[model samples]
Target: MATDTTTTAPARPPGTVSWWRRPWIAPLAIVTAVFLATALPRYVGLDPARSLVPTDRGPAFYPALVTHIFTGSVMLSAAVLQLWPWLRAHHPRVHRWSGRVYVASAIPTSIAALVVAQFPSGGVAQQVANTFLGVLLLTFTLLGYRAVRQRRFADHREWMVRSTALAFSIVTNRFWSTVLIAAYAPGALTDPDIGFGSPEIEGAAVASAWVSWIVNLMFAEWWIHRKPKRRSRVR
Candidate 1:
């Protein structure tokens, strides 16, 4: 008896994707979400520096602050689109245009950050962190573009990853700032009041930026080197 000859189709694997690989989705989503959340607030009548510790720089500070907000908004917005392959392919023109905008925005932002670093209300540690941020911003950006120009995808990806990570330092700085304030200040922490006098708060912010970047670099290295190592092992 040929009972119930009909057979069910095999089940597909869970979490499968065809257009883009699964691993990339998380990073892209994170970068996009961060960009929108951070950039949108700047224009929504929210002051970026409201949470920052006040600097004694006086009126000159407003202009710098305005520049920081504008440039940072542009930078973050551009960064969100950078990692999406669709933008680079289906919309090559937009990609190139946005790339130019990203580079342009980075100049003023990096310069302003470096300038502010010198007089950071958090003192020397904040200054150093900002300096490193500025230098890395300039270095990685140039390297990424240069790699692309030379058709070196590997180098371009490496440098761009580093640059993107540094850009996220803005996010990390705020996150760490909040964490430190919560741990150290408890109920005393408030918006529009950066607890700059506390060395612990300042140090945490500065340290977070460096730590974030270093961790990002290590991850990138592992990603880039892993395949080669595996191939060598197989051979």
Candidate 2:
């Protein structure tokens, strides 16, 4: 009668909850991937005069622009993969390889960004905004790399998350700039002083640059600190 003494434990859920698995993250990643895919290649294909960079930019600008876009395109494309939880969980080797690519790409991208920031197309506010972003991108990325070296996984994750958000700010900044332009477009097109390309657009660009990373980082921090939902226990 002692043969039926053993009991089976219940199966646990398949995986842990993680911010990377948030529903919104994938869609946003897809959209940004698409945008960078279209936009970056166009610039990469174009000569300096026809590219996004100003025609009269310095000698350093061309090389810097190329480096920024090439590395940025690689970084951004790989970035989407980095946030995919399934990849991290099921294919950790791939995740680690992708992280290496990301960190390597960030090195040249951040350096190029800093170089280009010094010769901003917009005014003082734009310069300041871009410089802050460039420095932050470089600093945070290095910190993340250092954390990984130290085996501080949590710190690495946080710093790298911040770095990624800063990089992605380029997308958010452009989106915000477009929104601001659309808000003012009707008036801007009508007014002789503010038509098409003008200081008003530049002003919006400055504001967008500052707000994008700042807001994204703030949101990232909130997301990182958010309490995990407790799964119900079953007997």
Candidate 3:
């Protein structure tokens, strides 16, 4: 008779997330999904009228803007999926496909954003902020891609983390803009005359354009540089 010596993996404790899972990621994915659905409806119709293009922007601008939004929405959707750890762990093909989609969508989106940022509605500061953001996003995304090609997966993850943070910054930009508008334009919610285009709100919006991504990148850096806990040696 032979004695069985098979060992099974221990089950996870109930109602607890694995340490491998980042607590912030799932909630961020959900918020990104919901906000994207609500905010991007105007672009879904591809109506140039909805976009409120400044006349000097010319016909080319609207198309580029539409491309930027359309592709950016795809990038955002893919990004939400890409960052989900379970999917990456269990469904590698899905992860790869989403990554491909993200990379493909990001390039055109960044390029179009670079074009659009030149004609900022808020102010020179906002234009400079957006242009800077567009450049960084494009750079981070490419570096991530290059890292993967070179088989430097750790570096790839870090770079993608940066690119994704910047990509998702638009959501924060909206949140910050609303808060800043409320602060800058008192009674804005109640007063019909204090429209979105009012100078007070415009100033706030300009501030938000800079603040949103800077805040996001700050958080991303924190996540990236956080010290890992050392496991105790069990005798």
Candidate 4:
């Protein structure tokens, strides 16, 4: 009897994809473009500078706010790029450089977040939520950096997931704010244009702040643990 020998390819890892090479990347790229379009203008150059300074937030607010916006934009873009598995797998050098930029941006972004939190425009609840978010962002990003340095990829991924979730608080907060504002505006106790002390605004602010990062992180945790494990087959 003659036996033919053939080598079989190993199975692809579950849920893995060549996201960078797929046509489906268009949707992701479009979304990223839209994000850049909306978020960039809000925090870039003279636009925000003119709007935030001298009159409204005062001179003291400029430094923190400026740092927050600039670093935030960088961090947001970097974090988004890092999520593409193809980039990390194929171009590890680029991934490392981007990771460094992301972590560096995260440091100042988080610090400015805390600074701005100290003078939160919302009520007590908003203040507490903001403070918690700022601290969590800083702590998680630092922990992620440390984990990666120590070659603890699992811990790094977890901490970075947490960090990115917090970073996305701004986006989630805007979404919640829009929803709540529209829903509560009719029954609001005070005019929307008036003051932060308004009960309606305060309630909405607190609700948005808490729901934003909390909900994001909950989903992140779910995603992180959603990977299916291979089981041993028993004969």
Worst window of 10 by summed lDDT in candidate 2: 12-21
For 1-235, candidate 3 gives per-residue lDDT tens digits of 9988876656534324464557867788788888878767877787766654443566677778888888999999999888877778778899999999999999999999888888777879989999999999999999999999999999999999999999998889878988888888878867878765679978987999999999999999998999978744433
Q: How accurate locally is residue 145 in candidate 4, as Cα lDDT from 0 to 100?
A: 95
Residue 118, model 4: Cα distance from true site in angstroms: 1.5
lDDT of 1 by residue, 1-235 (tens): 6688666655434333245553674575686577557555644554546534464576566556667667877887787777666566677788778877887887788777776666666567667767888888888888988998899988887887777777767766566656756775565375446455666566666666566556666676676677642212211
Could you say which candidate leads in lDDT? 3
Error of 1 at 60 (Å): 4.3
Which window of 10 residues has the lowest lDDT sum in candidate 4? Answer: 46-55
**Residue range 1-235, candidate 4, lDDT tens digits:** 9786756656555335555545544664465567667766755664544542232554546678778878887888888777767777778898899889999999999898887776655657777888899999999999999999999999999999899888978766778886876665544534546445666666777788889999988998997889766654433
Whole-model lDDT per candidate: 0.68, 0.80, 0.85, 0.76
Model 4's TM-score against the true structure? 0.81
In angstroms, the error of model 2 at 96 is 0.4
Model 2: what TM-score? 0.86
Candidate order, TM-score descending: 3, 2, 4, 1
Q: Candidate 1: misplaced stretches above 4 Å?
A: 1-20, 23-51, 58-60, 187-194, 228-235
Please, what is the TM-score per model? 0.70, 0.86, 0.86, 0.81
Task: Indicate the residue-level lDDT of 137 in model 1.
Answer: 83
Candidate 1: C-alpha RMSD to true structure equals: 6.9
